[model samples]
Target chain A: MSVQERKQRERAERERLIVATARELAEQQGWDAVTTRRLAERIEYSQPVLYSHFRGKREIIGAVALQGATELAGALRAATVTADGPRARVAALARAYLDFAARNPAVYDAIFQLDGGLAYAQEDTPEPLKGAFAALQESLGEVAGNGVHAGLFTETFWAALHGLATLTRARRLPPEYIEQRVELLVDRLALV
Target chain B: MSVQERKQRERAERERLIVATARELAEQQGWDAVTTRRLAERIEYSQPVLYSHFRGKREIIGAVALQGATELAGALRAATVTADGPRARVAALARAYLDFAARNPAVYDAIFQLDGGLAYAQEDTPEPLKGAFAALQESLGEVAGNGVHAGLFTETFWAALHGLATLTRARRLPPEYIEQRVELLVDRLALV
Candidate 1:
């Protein structure tokens, strides 16, 4: 490999390291504790090096959110692939989405709650975000009834799943009723 | 009026004033700007007086959340009451819910996002919260279909509405599609 190519690869590797370290810190200690200075210390890099890759904590959070979106997209796609029918796939998708949020609370917050310096629902939205929506759309669109737009249906269904995930995490909903709620959502909403 | 009775009445009024001031301050400047010092100063009460009404910020937030719940219940009830049928009532309820969240962003945050020292979906849950669900169930129960628990169905529907509200607020979903999303949620989820 040429020297220039190697330098570019090293830069990409450092950026990945910074994002991974930030996500770890956020998951362990909450976002409030994930300051740039502390991230620098934990990553064993100078603050300047961290700043070189990310403008600040917000950009780092955006990176984590993007990585999280990519993961969520992959998980949703994998869960739906093995399901037998539209109804089963939708149910599996719901479970996978909720599980992702429950398992990765910090990353979920970065994508949904915190200011991650990411452009969402805009013309220039990032690829990973679009990918996450596409993941949901792939299954949900199949179940969206005639005369309904798939993208709109996906957004609505996605929002509902988001609500279930967040409210359950906040302890606003009974944990024991989670499966019942999911079943009800699928039975009631899925056209299949 | 008797002296003791008068004092009790006066104290209750003072508590209301404190809660209202804190809520207003929160709405205007945000929850971060809602320090006890600012609340006390705005209400023209000493810090001890503020403490007397509530222990600290968390309790103040709890008060706001309870108040917000009561208001939400009222809003939902008022909106659904005059609607022609189950479907129209559900649609009205959706509109009222999203409208409330948008109009009262800080209070909505208190009820959902922030830790407000409130019990939820439990035996010890607050009255206004119960009232809020009762309002939703009043309409949703009618359309819950056979053999399904209205409360569980209501919870699922509520989560969907919540997801729309929060995601829309966070800009995760396009604003222009808000009405379509609401319509889709009602059409898909509401049995009516």
Candidate 2:
């Protein structure tokens, strides 16, 4: 490969490294603790180098959100694919979603809560966000009738899942009954 | 009233004025703009006076959250009281919730997203928070079976509603379909 191509690849790798480091810092000590200077210190890079990769903390959050969206899509697809029936698939999907939120609270907050400056539900929305929505639409299509818009159903189902995940994380709900709640949601949405 | 008692009451009234001013500023310009100094300037009071009312911005947030919680409980009760059937009541409650979030984004954020140092789920939780939960549980009790725990069902249903509100505010879902989505959730959850 040419020298220029190799240098470009290296730059991309460094960008990914910065994002990974920021995500880890956020996960370890909530997003409030992840400062640019601390991120630079942890990655053993100058603050300027970090800024070269990201405009600011908000951009870094957007990068982490994109990474999270990709992971969430993969988990949703896996949950739906391995399940046996329509109701089972929906149940598994709900469980997988809640598990993801619990395991990655910071990343979830980045995507949903923080003002990451990422455009959502617009023409300029990122590919990862679209891909995540597609994954949900595909999974819900299994149970959604042909005349119904799968995208719409997916959005509604996703709203329910988000509610469960956020409320549970906030400790507004008892954690022990989460499984039963997911079961009820799946049975209710899928059976009818 | 005696002069000393009147003076004490005036001081308490000033504190309420400060909190109310801060809340209005947050609602108009978003939470990022509601700084202590700005609040002092808006209320025409000294910074020290503002500090006396609230230790800092966090305490102001707590006050706002409490107010929002009270408003939320009232809205839920109003919706619950007007509806006839379990399904209709649930749907109305969901609509009221989403509308409240949409109308009061900053207050909603203070109650749900920000770390305002308010206790949740414990017996020591603030009265407004507990009262809000009680209102939801009371409405949910109509649909939950006789043997089932109303609190658990309320939590699950609340989770779904919270998800819808947060996602809709974040633009993760289309605004036009919010009513249909709430209907779907109510129907699914209310069905025996």
Candidate 3:
């Protein structure tokens, strides 16, 4: 490889480190605690180095949100693709989506709650987000029922999963009822 | 009225004022700006007086959450009770839930997101919260489908409304799709 290509590779690696560090910091401490100074210190880089990579905290959050979206898309795909039937796939999708939210709350917050300087539900939306939704739609389309738009069906079902995740994470919904809630959702909403 | 009765009424009024002031402050500048010092000043009450009414910030948030719950319950009931059919009632309920979240974001956050020190989904959960769920259940119970548990069904539907509210609020979903999303949810999920 050329010398310039080697330098580009190193820069890409640095960017990943920065995003991963930001996500780890955010999860360990809430977003409020993730100042640029703290992030720079933890990553063993000078403030200027970190600034050169990300404009500030918002950009860092956006990077994390993107990575999280990709991870969520992968998790959902893995959960649904192997399921035997349409009903089983929808149930698997719901559980996987909620589990992603519960496991990576800080990342979830970045994607759903905090300002990540990202455009959504638009042609210019980040690839990872669109991918995440597409993963859900792939499985949900089969059970969308006749005459219903598959995208709309996916949006509604995704919202239900989002609700379950956020509410469950907040402890507003009791944990014991999680399974029953999933069952009720699939039994009533999924045409299969 | 006797002086004791008058004092009791005055105290209740003062508590209401505190909650309202906090809600207004939170709405205008977000929750972080609604500090105790700012709250005491807004209510024209001494810090000690504010303390006498409630323990601290957590209690104040709890008070706001309870008030919001009561208000949401009223709104949902008013929207659904007069709708012409089960499908219409469910759609109206979804609209009302999203509208409540959009109109009173701070209050909605207190009830759903922020640490309000409120019990939920348990036998000892607070009254206003229980009432709010029942308000949703009243309409949702009609369209829960045969052999499905009403409470679980309501929980799932409520989660969908919540997901739509939060996601729409965050602009993760485009605004133009709002009505279509609601229509799809009602048509596909409701047994009607």
Candidate 4:
């Protein structure tokens, strides 16, 4: 490889290492404990070296949120693709969304709660954020009635799923009834 | 009043002053700025005196969450009572919820996101927490189909609303479509 190409590859690798380390630290001790100093120590790098890759903790969170949005989109696509019917697809999507939140609480918080400095709902919003919403709309559009505004319906459905994930994580909803609740949401939203 | 009664009343008044100061600071600059030391200074009380009322920052957050929950329940109840039908009631409830979250971002964060040591979904869950859920469920029950489980439906509906609120606050959803989204949610959950 040329010198410039080799250096570019090395830079990308270092960025990956930093994000992986931040994710591990956040998962291990929660987001509050994942300070820039702690992250540098964990990765055995100087704080300045870490700063070269990320502007600050918020930027690191933004990186993580982007990674999470990609994963969420993939999961939603998988759930929707494998289902047999529109209602089943919606139900699977809800379950996948909730399951992702349950498994990655810190990442979920980064994407949904923390001040990640990522632009949202604006023309300048990052591609990953738009991609995630598109994934949901693709699945939901199949169920929304013809002549009905699918985008609006998707927004409401997405809102409901987000609520369930947050409420469940907050322990506001009983754990054992999660499936039934998802079913209810799908059934209600599916019927024309 | 006797001397003991006067002293007790004075202490209660001081506690109220402290909480009010904290709430104002939070509203002005967000929750991150509402530190215990800042609150103490704002209330013109020593750190120890503030601690006498609240164990620490987390306890103060819990107090704020409780207060927010009470207000949330009142809003939900008012919305439900004023609506002419089940779908209208649910729409009203959703709008009220979004309005509350938008107006009291700090208090909403305290109840939903911050670690306040408040028990939830457990046998020992606090009354305010249960009261908030009860308020939502009471309205949801009016629209939920016969044979649909009340708790499960309420949870699903709540999840959707919560998702919308958090996403809107995070700027993940467009603000202009909030009313339309609520209408879609009500329609999806009610007769369509």
Highest DockQ, which number?
4
Candidate 2 — what's its lDDT? 0.84
Report the C-alpha lDDT of model 2 over A111-140, residue by residue, as the tens digit.
877778899888889999998888877768
Every model's TM-score: 0.91, 0.94, 0.88, 0.94
Q: Candidate 4: give the clashing pairs.
A: A160-B160, A163-B159, A163-B163, A164-B159
lDDT of 3 by residue, B20-99 (tens): 89999999998999988889999898788888998889999999999999999999999988999998899999999989
Interface RMSD of each: 0.9, 1.4, 1.3, 1.3
Tens-digit lDDT track of model 2 for B32-111: 99988898888788789877767788988999999999999999889878888777787788888888999999899889
Q: Candidate 1, clashing residue pairs?
A: none
Q: Order the candidates by lDDT, highest first — what do you get? A: 1, 3, 4, 2
What is candidate 4's lDDT per residue for B136-162, written digit by digit as tens?
Answer: 988888777888877777878777878
The DockQ-derived docking category for candidate 3 is medium
Give residue B153's error in model 3 in angstroms.
1.1
- For candidate 4, give the docking quality class from DockQ: high
Compute the lDDT of residue B107 as modeled in candidate 4: 89
**lDDT of candidates 1 onward, in order:** 0.91, 0.84, 0.89, 0.84
Alpha-carbon runs more than 4 Å astray in model 4: A1-5
- Which wins on lDDT, candidate 1 or candidate 4? 1
Model 3: residues >4 Å from true position, as ranges? Answer: A1-12, A32-37, A45-49, B1-14, B44-52
Per-residue alpha-carbon lDDT of model 3 for A1-192, expressed as tens digits? 699999999999998998988899989997888988898898888888888988778888999999999999999999988999999999998888888898899999998888889999899998998999999999999999998888888888888888988998888887777888887777767898
